[model samples]
Target: MPASPSAKIRANVPIPLSEKAIATRFVSFSGLNDDKEHIAIIYGSPEQQEAPLIRIHSECLTGDVFGSQRCDCGEQLHEAQRIMSAEGGVLLYLRQEGRGIGLYNKLDAYALQDTGVDTYTANEMLGFAHDQRDFTPAIDMLKALGLKRIRLLSNNPHKADDLVKAGIEVTERVQTGVYVNQYNAEYLKAKVDQQDHSITLKQN
Candidate 1:
């Protein structure tokens, strides 16, 4: 059986505070239904009538926290903050590790990937879907914040689809791209090929 909605855990965690010269406001909350800790950096004036730009990024402890280069999570996050700070929007950092498979299993999948398996194949071997995350909590949180619509920042079409389906009007999709290095080339390809993520690689 699928896990119950309440089985998901949530916690309030502080992000490493930033002192950069950007207009940013930090907020943290937990998703009780999904049990995910969430941190947000709100940029721009919330009173602006324009549709707020938002990014619902799932937590990647290895990549975001540990500076692992096997994937572009950390880079994408930094890019999100940079853009949002400049343009005005919100960065919703969701704590769904490994696309909701949790930490230990994600590490296990990493070991499998190191042995020549791609990310999709590794997740399958570990009895998981290619992406097990759901965006319902994001929708709820946006509503709670009184955001009626947003220009979403993402390369994944499904994120737009999911938010729209959940009644959050997505006005536009803002692309977030990063350079592909030797460490994350295969991983990025797996995202494009297997997950059908719409990522544009930086041209040499």
Candidate 2:
């Protein structure tokens, strides 16, 4: 078990919220050939090397940062943060943007999607997997944090499966919030239909 990670660590003092105050720590994974530098954000410290809440959030520039309603990424990210804030856990913000197809490639897929296509097929049309993301970075971060078990937070069943496959014990699976908007209703439905996401939306 790694007590301390070899990655660069920086402390963000006094991360204040409307209802609470917490400390945020950013751990930068070193020596990556990928153009994007990935990091792990620890919300609240866990008591010991035990199973804690973890959200392996892939980067979503449009939805997460810009609050785009084209998908539910922003809503899910915020919901995961709020939950982990109260319960205590780590959020591994992976740099696997656009499901590991890069940002511009994702943007191109978005254009294809606008042409009456779904999310999954759009990626295929671009010669990529439905989700090209790999959870190895997340597994490494958890191991570095001295955690072998986790209560994974996600609606995508494949996330937990991937963690388990990476030799981490998923003690519990927490379903993050689902935000259904006019712009992303079809997208959400397509996820449930094709991606096997466990999202419960109001049926029409």
Candidate 3:
């Protein structure tokens, strides 16, 4: 068996909170070289401490940053923040754009999408994996935060599996569903059919 990661190595710096309304702390690791990759801990109410919740959110610049509705990325991000603020948890915002294929390539993929290619097929055509994101860094971040277990909020079963494989005990799986729009309806279907993401179409 592979040696478990040392706790000391996992414990990095405690970044001071930036936002006043919602207390936030930033954390980083050398293992994740990308400067944009950051883990933000949003403190919950003073009473809820035992079994804090966590959401490993990969960055979606077009969505999270620019409010793009191409997919449900932005909505889910805002929803995660809202829920974490109420219940208390950490949001590990990874900089794995376009499922780890990077930004420029993602735009290329978008172009392919415009030509009738589904999201998965577009990535394949671009010589990329279905989902190139790795959850190891997230594990490291959670460990650094002194978290032994968490109630993970996500729609992807792979996220849960990756966390468990990395030795972070997942106590519960929280569902986060976003409304599907005409722009991303096919894209979302490809995620469900090809990637095994647990997202269903919302009935009107």
Model 1 misplaced regions, further than 4 Å: 1-20, 28-31, 201-204
List residue ranges in candidate 3 displaced over 4 A.
Answer: 1-22, 31-36, 45-48, 202-204
Q: Report every candidate's CA lDDT.
A: 0.77, 0.79, 0.75
Clashing residue pairs in candidate 3 are none
Cα shift from native, residue 160, model 3 (Å): 0.3
Judged by whole-model lDDT over C-alpha atoms, candidate 1 comes out at 0.77
RMSD vs true structure, all candidates: 4.0, 3.5, 3.5
Error of 1 at 140 (Å): 0.7
TM-score, one value per model:
0.85, 0.87, 0.85
Question: What number of clashing residue pairs does each candidate have, in the order they appear?
Answer: 5, 0, 0
Candidate 1: 10-residue stretch with minimal lDDT: 1-10
Clashing pairs in 1: 8-34, 8-35, 9-35, 9-36, 10-35
Better of 2 and 3 by TM-score: 2
lDDT of 3: 0.75
Candidate 1 lDDT over 5-90, as tens digits, reads 33222332334335663466666544345555566666766548478889999999998888898888998988887776567787
Error of 3 at 139 (Å): 0.6
